[model samples]
Target: MRTPPPRVLTVAGSDSGGGAGIQADLKTMLALGTHGMSVVTAVTAQNSLGVQGAWPLPAEAVRAQFRSVVDDIGVDAVKTGMLASAELVETVAALLDEVTAPVVVDPVGISKHGDALLAASARDAVRTKLLPAATVATPNLDEVAWLTGVQVASETGLRRAADAILSYGPRWALIKGGHLEGDAVDLLTDGSEEHWLRAPRHDNRHTHGTGCTLASAIAAGLAKGCSVPEAVRAAKTYVTGAIAAGFALGAGIGPVDHGWASPCRQPKVSPSGV
Candidate 1:
């Protein structure tokens, strides 16, 4: 018999555009040589233009799906994104209590097109319940601004945001500063040692799915036995290459290429030399 690949599960929304949310999380897991599974929390009618409609899965339904997967196939790591409501967030948080694997939480607040995906009421549940269960919390600039009052203007400000988010109880925090100008720098800290990750900002506008991809990649690494810092470092390298290989597909913003494993698979050599 053949050995099975590492198992990574995503609890998130579905994007019809296949760029972000559960779609991107599964793609990233597969690209990184993991067995990807999903417990979809919402179904979104979205394209490159933006989210047109969204319907969250009922709390019972979400719990049932989670129980079904985790009870049998078993998960090595879990990644969460786009829990649309407070009820759903709490439901997932409760279900996760039974899981013994590491978790990566991507507190998805909005879309690349500026459409709100998470409700305001869900923020508190995420902070109080979901975050404490996370091995790492990955938040973008806007998400950091939403979860914590801190507005990150530069790399220096990321530390402040990380500090605020760390108080929420995640073992580690990764503050993505892609929204800032110049180099795309991110800060990862365990409330002690801080690792500053800096990569040249690609001029690509097709960077949809970046947040989900990075978080899921980290979860996959953790599932395969990488340390928190090691997992984050590998994930950063993966996403930087993905962003560089991003290609235009839909009418609006396209998605980062998650399958950029080897140099031969990349579309073009980005300025960052990914």
Candidate 2:
């Protein structure tokens, strides 16, 4: 009999376009050699063009899915995205506190095509409830501004952004500086220690699922037992390749290639922590 791989669970919305959200997380997990599981928090009428409609699941429904997965199969790590509303955010946050595994929270605020994935009322829930339960909280530039009122205009502002996010109580704060010019840089810190992850910017415009893909990749790494800095560095490497290999899909922006690193056996990450 074959040995089962490490299990990783994603609690996020589903993208009908098969690009971001639950779809991206599963794809990334499989590519990274982990068993992927999911608890879909919502379903979106999304395409490469944009998110047309989104309906969040009830708090009870979300709870049932999480319980079903963790109760039987068990999980080595968990990642969250696009909780949609305050009820769902609070619900998932409460659920996470009971788990023994590490949690990666991608405080998804907006879609690639400028659609809001999180409600304004839910922002408080993310900062207070959701973030406090996370092992690592991954937030992009725009998310930094809206979540903590820290407007990061250049690379120099990433530290301030990380500091603001760390105050919310996550064990580690990964401030994605992907929206900045020049290099694609990110800051990973846990108050005392820091690691600056930098990759050459890919000139690909079809990089739609960047945030979800990166956060999920980080969770996959954690499931496989990589330390916070190690997991994040490897995830950054994986996402950089994905962005570089992004292909044109529909008339609008497309998704990062979640499978792009598989062929090279490139992720080759070292196992370390939760």
Candidate 3:
């Protein structure tokens, strides 16, 4: 029999746009040669324009889904995004503590178009509860500032930002500097070692889902047994290609092409029945 692929689980919200959140996470996992599973925490009425509405699931529902996946199929790695509320953040954090796998926490506070995805009350919960359970915390420049209060105007401030995030208790912090004015840069550090990842800025404005894609890609790499630095480097290269190949979707910004690795691979159809 063929060996099964590494399994990565994403506990996140649903993005109807198929760009960010659970959709992006699963696509990133698949593109990186991993099997993806999901435990959705919220449902959003969204498109390329922005999120029109969002409804978070009850904590019980979230817990049930997580148990259903991890208890049976099992996960080699976990990635989380868009917890929506303080309750959900704390709930997910508690569940993460029970998981032996590496966890990637993408502290999603805002949408690509500046729309708010996280609640104001949940910020403290994420900083205190969610981040502490993370193997790697990936935050964009805006998220970094929101979580750390350290505004990153240039690359020089990335270290300070990473330091602030690390102080919150994640084993490593990856501060994404894509919002900066030059080449896209990110800093990954575990308080002792640092990896500065730099990529040529693609002139594409449709780079939606970049953060989610990067985090899930890193989780997929970890599931495949890569070290933290190796997983992050591979994820950076993959997301860079996806950004370069991004295309227009609607009246607003489009999504990064998660299938950039196998651009010509055809979709598969499952067999009729077991």
Q: Residues 1-274, candidate 2, lDDT per residue (tens digit)? A: 9999999999999999999999999999998999999999999999999999999999899999999999999999999999999999999999998999999999999999999999999989999999999999999999999999999989899999999999999999999998898878899999899999888776679898899999999999999899999999999888887887787899999898887756564322311100
Candidate 3 lDDT tens digits, 111-150? 9988898999998999999999999999998998888788
TM-score of 3: 0.95
Q: Between which residue pairs do clashes occur in model 1?
A: none
> In terms of TM-score, which candidate is strongest?
1
C-alpha TM-scores of all predictions: 0.97, 0.95, 0.95
Instruction: Indicate whether candidate 1 or candidate 2 has the larger TM-score.
Output: 1
Candidate 2 Cα lDDT to native = 0.92
Kindly report the root-mean-square deviation of model 1 from the true structure over all alpha carbons.
1.3
Candidate 2 lDDT at 260 equals 76
Minimum summed lDDT over a 10-residue window in model 3 is located at 265-274
